[model samples]
Target chain A: MSFLRTAPAFRAGLGMRTIHTSRVAAVQASKQVRAIAADETAGFKYTAENAILKGTVNDAVAVPTPNKAHGSYHWAFERLVSAAIIPATVAAAVASPTAHPIMDGVLGVTILIHSHIGFSACIDDYVDERKFGALGTACRWLLRVGTAGALVGIYEFNTNDIGLTELCEKVWKA
Target chain B: MARRFVQTNSISEMEGLKLLNTQRMNRPVSPHLDIYQPQVTWVLSGLHRITGVAVAGVFYVGALTYLLHPIYPAIDSAHLIEAVHNLPVWFKTSAKVAFALPLTFHSFNGIRHLMWDTGKGLTMKGVYASGYAVMAASVISTIYLAFFV
Candidate 1:
C-alpha cells in the first residue's frame, strides 16, 4: 500500500516537470517575439527621421542658389541662339543668290552683285578694325552696307521714268 | 611702431568733366543730333519681302493683260498697246491706271527700303507696325490708281 501511494506522487511530479518545461519555452518565445517587434519599430522610426531631416536640409541649403542659376542660364542661352544666329543666317542667304543657279541674267546679276558687295563689306570690316579703332568698327559695317544700299538706290533711280539719265548727263558735263 | 599712409586718389568722373569744360569755355555749343540713335522696325523687313512678291505678281498681271489685250481690244487695249496711241480720254485714263500698279508698288517699297537703310524698323513692335503701315499704303495707292487713274 505505501508503494501505490508513492507511484501517484511520482506521476504528479512528472506531469509538473513537463508543464514547467513548456511554460519556460512559451515565455522564451514570447520574449523573442517582443524583441523582434521592438527592433522593427526602432528601425522604422530611424529611417523616417533620417528621410525627414535630409529633405528639410536639402530644401534649406540648395533652393535659392541652384534654382536661380539654372533659370537664368537656360533663358539667356535660348534667347541668344534665337535672336543672333537665325537673323544672321537669313542675311547671309539674302546676300547669296547662287543658291538658284537657273535664275535669269537680270536676277543672277543682282544676286552676284549683292553677294560680292557683302563679302567686300565683310573684308572692309576686318580692315577697319586695324585702321579705324573700335568706335569706327561699329560704323564700318554700316558704311559698307550703306554704300551697297546707295548703289541699289541709284539702280532704282536709273530704271525709273524720273529722267535720271538726263540728270546724270548734266552732272557728268557730257 | 608707427605706420604712415599717403592719402592720394585719382580724380572722379564729375571732376574730370568739370576740368574739361573749364578748359573749353569759348567752344561753340551745338546740340548733338547724331548721338541719338533712332529706333528700327524689324517686322517691316518681312513685309518688304511680301511686297516684293506682290510686285512680281503685278508684273505677271501686266504680262497677262498684254497677252489677252488683242483678243478683247474693245474691252481694253491699254494692256496691249506696246506703242503710244491717240485714244479716247477714258481709254487713256484706263491705260494709266493699268500701268500704275507696278510703278506704285516699286515706289512705295523703295521708300520702305529707304527707311530700313536709315536703321529704322528693327524692333518687334516697330516691325509689325511698319508692316501694317506698308499694307495700308499699298492698299490706298492701289485703290487710287486702279479707280482714279
Candidate 2:
C-alpha cells in the first residue's frame, strides 16, 4: 500500500462513482465477466459487484484496446465474402459443374469460409473466451481443425467424384 | 404528524456503495425491448440463424465424411446418392423438403441481409415488405423444388 487515490470512472459505463484504486489495483481490476448476479452464468460482472469494477470503486474498465483485425476490417471482410457467395451461388446453379470444375471448387471454398465465419460468430457470442475460458478456446480450435479437414475433403471429392452440382442433381433426380 | 408509511435509514458510504452495486446486479439488463420474444420479427431472425446453422452443419458433415472414404473406401458421394435413392418415396419427399426448406429460406433471407448491407430496405415498412416477400418466395420455391422439380 504505497499509494491510495480515487480515480475517475471513465470506463465504468455502469456507474459514475469515483473508484478508489492504486496502480496495482487498476492492473488487477478486470473481474471475470458475468451476466447474471447468480455467478453461474457467463456475462458482465453482476453478483461479484461487491468488489466494484475490479477491487476498487474507480478501477479502469477492462475494454480491449481496438485492433483492426477484429474491428472494422473484420466486418468489411465478412460482408465481402457473403456478397461474393451470392454471385458464386447463382453461377454454380447455372453452369455445368463437370465442365467448369474451377467454379465448383470456388463455390466449395466460399461455402467453407462462410460456414467457418458464421459458426465462429456463434461461438464468440455464446462461449466467449473472455467468459468461458478454456472451453471457448477449445471450441474455436476444434472448428479450425474441422474446417481444414472439410477443405481437404471437398478437394478430394471434387477431384475423384462428380463435382458438387452433379452430386446434388443426381441425388435430387434419384 | 400524519401517519407515515416511509422509513429512512442512514448508512456508511461503503455500505451505500455496496447496496447500490447489488441493486445494479439484480436490475434487468435490458432497456426497451426484451432479449428474446416469439414475435414474427424475432422469430424470422432466429430462423435465419437456425436454418443457416442446419444447412451449413449438413454441408460440413457431408464434406468432412469425404475424408473417411480413403480409410473406409465406401464413404463416398456415390453411396450417398444411392442411399437416398433407395429410401421410400415418402421418406425421400420428406428428406427433400427438409433439405430444400433451409436452403431456400437461408438463401432468401441471406439476400435480404445483403440488401441490408447495401443500406437498402432497412425501414420498418421496407423490412416487413422484404420479409414477407422472402417467406412467400421460399415456401413456393421449396414446394416446387421438393415436389415438382
Candidate 3:
C-alpha cells in the first residue's frame, strides 16, 4: 500500500521534469522560425471562429439515385416465380409423357425467368461496373444473349420434342 | 539524475497527412467473416445463392447440349437416357437424388424468402422454424422424386 501511494508521486516528479524541459525547448524552437514573406501573409486574416466553406461545390452531382422500390419488387417477383415453379415442375414431371402443353409452357417461362434472375444476381456480385468496367459490360451483354438463347431453346424443345420435365423423368428412369 | 531530452521537429502538414493516411490503410477492418457466429439466416441465404447458381448452370448446359443435337446424336434426350440406364443401380439412384435435392431445397427456401419480402417470418424464431421446414421438405421431396416419382 505504501509503495503504491509513493509510485504516483514519483511519476508526477518525472512528468514535471519532462514538462519543464519541453517548455525550455519550445522557447528555443520559437526563435528558429524564419520570417514570413510579405506576400505569404498579404491575404491572410485571423479570426476567432473557424470558417468552413459551405456549398462551394456539389459532391453528389455524379451519384445515381437507386430505385429501392423497383429493386424490392423485382426481388419479390423472382422469389414468387421460383416458388410457383416447384408445383409446376412436380406436376409436369409426374404427368410425364402426356403432360399438358400449357404446363410445359408455364414451366419453360418460369424456369427461364428464375435462371435469368439468379444469373444476374451472380453477375452483379462478381462483375460490377465499379470493379471491372469494360469486362462487366461485356458480361452483362453475354448474359442477355445467353438468356435469349436459352428461352428459344426451351421453347423449341417443348414444341418439337418431349418437354423438359418429361426428359428428366426419362433420364431418371434410365 | 539529470534526464537527457532529445528534441524532435514537428512534421510538415503533407507528411502528417501522409502518415494519417498510412495509419488508416493499416487499420484492421471490422465485421470480418470470422467474427460473426454462423446463423440460419445467412447460412440459408448463402445456400440459396449456391443452389441458384447450380440450377442455372444445369439448365444452361442442358439447353446448350440440346442445341447441339444435330452435330451430336448422343446429346439427344433418348441417348442421354440410354447412357444413364447403363450406369449401376447405386449411381443412378444417387444421381437422381443429388439432382432433385438442390432443386427442392432452393424452391422451398425461395418461398421462405418471398414470405420475408412480404414482411413475414423474419423474427429469429420464425427464421429457424422456416429454415428447418425447408430442409425437411427438401429431404422428403428428394426421396419421393428419386424413389417414387
* Cα interface RMSD of each candidate: 25.7, 6.5, 10.7
lDDT of 3 by residue, B1-149 (tens): 98869987797544544444444445454655567799877888888989878888899877756777667756666777788889998888888888888888888898888788789988989999999999999999999988886
> Between the candidate structures 1 and 2, which one is better when assessed by lDDT?
2
Model 2 chain B worst lDDT run, 10 consecutive residues? B29-38
User: Backbone clashes in each candidate structure, one number apiece?
Assistant: 9, 7, 0
Candidate 3 has which clashing residue pairs, if any? none
Could you give candidate 2's per-residue lDDT for residues A95-152 as a string of tens digits?
Answer: 9898998898999999899999999999987787766767889999999999999999
Candidate 3 lDDT tens digits, A83-133 = 878788777766644558678778877888888888887878877654566
> What is candidate 1's lDDT per residue for A23-79, written digit by digit as tens?
888888775221121112211222211221111111242234566545777545433
CA-based DockQ, model 1 = 0.01
lDDT per residue (tens digit) for residues B1-149 in model 1? 87868776697444543444344443455655345554334334434444444543443333333333336554232222322334565675565555555445544655555565568876767666765676677668866755653
Please report, as a value between 0 and 1, the fraction of native contacts recovered by candidate 1: 0.00
Best by lDDT: 2
Scored against the native two-chain complex, candidate 3 gets a DockQ of 0.18
> Model 2, range B78-141, lDDT digits (tens) per residue?
8888898899999899988999999999999988998998999889999989989999999999
TM-score of each: 0.24, 0.75, 0.69
lDDT of candidate 2 at residue A155, scale 0 to 100: 94
Chain B only, TM-score of each candidate:
0.37, 0.78, 0.79
Model 3 CA deviation exceeding 4 Å by range: A1-63, A66-73, A90-99, B1-35
